[model samples]
Target: MSLEAQYLANKLAKGFVGTNQIESNSRLCMASAGTGYKLSLGADGPPGSYRDFEKADVFFVIGSNTADCHPILFLRMMDRVKAGAKLIVVDPRRTATAEKADLYLQIKPGTDLALLNGLLHLLHENGHTDPDFIAAHTEGWEAMPGFLAEYPPATVAEITGIPEAGIREAASLIGRAGEWMSLWTMGLNQSTHGTWNTNALVNLHLATGAICRSGSGPFSLTGQPNAMGGREMGYMGPGLPGQRSVLVDEERAFVEELWELPPDTLRKDGVGQGAVEMFQKMADGAIKACWIICTNPVASVANRGTVIEGLEAADFVVTQDVFAETETNTYADVVLPGAMWTETEGVLINSERNLTLASPATDPPGEALADWQIIARVACAMGYEKGFSYESAEDVFEEIKRAWNPKTGWDLRGVTYERLRAGSVQWPAAREEGPDRNPIRYVDRDGELSFPRASGRAVFYARPHIPAAEMPDDDFPFVLNTGRLQHQWHTLTKTGKVARLNKLNPGPFVELHPQDARELGIVDGDAVEVASRRGRAVLPAVVTDRVRPGCCFAPFHWNDLFGDCLSINAVTSDAVDPVSFQPELKVCAVGLAKVSSPRRPCPSPSSRLRSSTCTDH
Candidate 1:
């Protein structure tokens, strides 16, 4: 299904006369990490594997609440901790994951790059960096030290709100560890300067020579199951199949030849519009049509007013989804019922590069078809019969195998459907016969480092800290940080409907520090109006010390389906990182005020506090 989607996207680019509008939901989540990896490490995938969790001497977790968001992997890290590995967590909130950390730095929101640079400076000052490794395996290293010096501990402490001692402690822990793996997620990626944040995090590993080894590297935790799979298939506007970019001439030629198309079939002048730009263009009437698949952009996209305007302005809109009641469906000119996961078979790649074949367990309820079938049928209808003539999902997978270019080091030729049926396999499976799966990238069998860049070495970026596009001021005095809860997923598509999960997380509520709650004359369970420059949402306030005094936290799960004016994304900033074009969904400025009257009263304070724990600072 993923392959067919890419195939259709490529075909559309060929048939259409303008820039390709194809973009993935990953643009909102992991595009910054992807751009950062490619710029620094010559690739998009993480260099480390889950096995690193068990063998690492230290776990440096930042911007991720692993206990709630990635419980299974968190369990492995905790298991390693029990065997005497130190754990360090850094975030704006003192989350459930931070409770188990040897050290937790409650840094201010959107200060990750500063905090990271400060740590690197402290590491260098403490003589922890490996100069030999820097000289041998990395380029552009000479430019970093001078830039890093600007972010000394005292200055970074003022910027990040972490005590100077806390900054020194984190630096000491990371510097002293023989092997440490850094893990992060949307907290670092969902920012206006998200790409730099990722680069700074990677710089630590490079400086310490803590990467391309058994138990050390920078690993990005993915928010979705098959987001990596989608990247592999090149579903984004700037990508071709097999992780090849449209901007590269050789890569474009390889894909064109494999697809049996003429020269210059793919666009190479410049990259296409990204997710944010795609919708903005739609609203401006530059783009006339859109085909949305398996995503609820109305509730999920930041600055959703613009997204709704885009949908409303488009000449035609097609929504392919399993559920008919998604917020996006309201804007669709045509609603194509697509089979759900259990009713369709496909391959799903996870953060660790493992490919698992998902087999159907049940049939579709009505006239629903698999997503690939729907796309293929549409392609045939549009007179692209030869390119999209796939009889089964296996046929599409076989074509995807032919499209895999081994030079990208993501070789998928050996990842056949039959092999996948037997068991899950990791990629870079270049050969038909041996265990071609490599856990770590950039390192060959002889333990020699070989990056895929033209220089055959990784690049060091001297990125300085940049504040979030929108910062809190007197008018909007609180930074609104959005995230997921343990019991709910994005927009609560399926999880919200489940009885037990609903019981686990009753409804949407805002987390406010007790001091801020008191200052605003709001109490736990009191109705509070959280207003941003763009929009506003009214929810119960949970006066918890989990959040910083000047920062508020809310789960971005609730929408109109739950209740009136419940979508938190309506209040998120659409400001995008210049490099990755990913929106800063994590941090935005907002003001809070108590509501004197409420249409629907909130649940008891105890019920609301059950999901999120609180403590007095």
Candidate 2:
């Protein structure tokens, strides 16, 4: 963690005079995973690393469209598939990832918990569960089987819309597999039942001793590259570095002494705002000055119209990012030019917990600065001079090492800047271990059980299924799902500038089932307007069979800054999971309309775009 952020988190939490809050974009993408991981195993990062991908015989890739978002990791999975590993993809859309699956369970949206419980029911019925392991290394495992009784194949099939036979077949594949590695992303995390979705997936591993094995565990593929690092460094609310929480007295005391601050620097009586709630506080005039860095939340946050209104309502708003022309900067009171990825040097921790040092390939443009440097300057300006004087990125690295204390079990003392610059290494590699030593978690395979939980054992959550916060009705007759395109990165701040990339997906478009399109009198190039109770988006429509009949897909990458088109989040619902507070961005109800514009339809990037380039599925 940066000293500036740590100090402020402490101050703000303590309700120190003149301080209000410190929030981040971390809550939007990984909050549910974070909450579930901590609840299940009593920590942030997952027990399994990417190395498990190489040793596994069965890969359950659910919720995530790995082929689009984490293309490199998906390539590795494909290598395993070719080597005879069976792949199972669970999703509502026939995504690129699902197309490669040995079994694609086209589940009903928001019914993942039911499907997972149904798997456990089958596992128990077939006597595939590992009672010895559960008895020895787990708490609450005895109770899970009883809960699974309510969700038999027939019952789950009714809710999930997957055939009962398909459910049984999937259960058999997962049950009898040599090793299992389960993965998911936004599709599971961005929903009202996100935490439950995650815990339910984890339940499978706990039920059958599928975790902590050489190639077995539940893995949440990070949407953002350094999301794991951000969590480890206490970027979220109620957090301190080393996976410590402010709510814990011992952890709070450790942080207080680590920074040599007054005992009251961090508040005791209140919790800070998350991303979704922060905007609510802003609109209600409870917060004054708001600062956003790195993320383009204006175009990305669920309910785009409301978030922009909150930004506008702030007394003072600051946006620090690479682009000067972003929709966010349009409303900013001050713009701090942040250096782009190619123009900055720092460490990025990927989904697997590997610490990778990214070196700048070119100098930053005029007046722009690295993210950390900008933060340091701002801290000094705010009169925190002593700790804010960082000479280089390595200075921050040294501080991070200090913050990664032994007690945290994420001891990174061996991972020096010099060693990291040469290669990456996973966390928990202590100084006694070599600098290059990589680590996997939870040593249960050798009959030695270790969970990060206070009980010294993993906990199985009997979480129940909950429907999506918003569902389609007569007024809003289709479910609107928003996500990424293969060639276009989030918001397209950098990729949109590429001519070749533009030739792939030229503008904003919504993908609906051809049956729904035909029923609504829409065509491939028809201009359409999709509306929700919150807002509306106008874009070109793509009639495809990839999405289910009542569900539609829209790429969340385009906006006025990129193609002078609509942002999908405008029509996305802001309803959030009560536990994670992450908006239900993946599923919402919207009505689609065919626009009768007098102007000619924009030319398709090429005829093959409908086939080759539309990776939205």
lDDT leader: 1
Tens-place lDDT digits, model 2, residues 1-617: 23333333333333223233555556667888888887787777778778888999999988889998889889999999999999999988899999999999998777888998999899999998999888877899768777889999999999999999999988999899989999988788877777777888888898899887678999998877677877777766777777777777877777677666667565544466566666767877888778788777777776555566678788999888888888777778999887876777777777777888777899999999887888777777777766567788877677667666543367667787788777887877676356464546755236576887667888899988777666666666777777788898888888989999889978778887888887777777777766555545557778898988887888888875654337665221112324222222222112333254412232121211111111121
RMSD of 1: 5.6
TM-score of 1: 0.92
Clashing pairs in 2: 10-265, 13-266, 13-267, 14-266, 14-267, 95-617
lDDT of 1 by residue, 420-448 (tens): 88888887787667483568887787889
Q: What RMSD, rounded to one decimal, does every model reach?
A: 5.6, 5.9
Compared with the true structure, the alpha-carbon lDDT of candidate 2 equals 0.72
TM-score of each: 0.92, 0.90
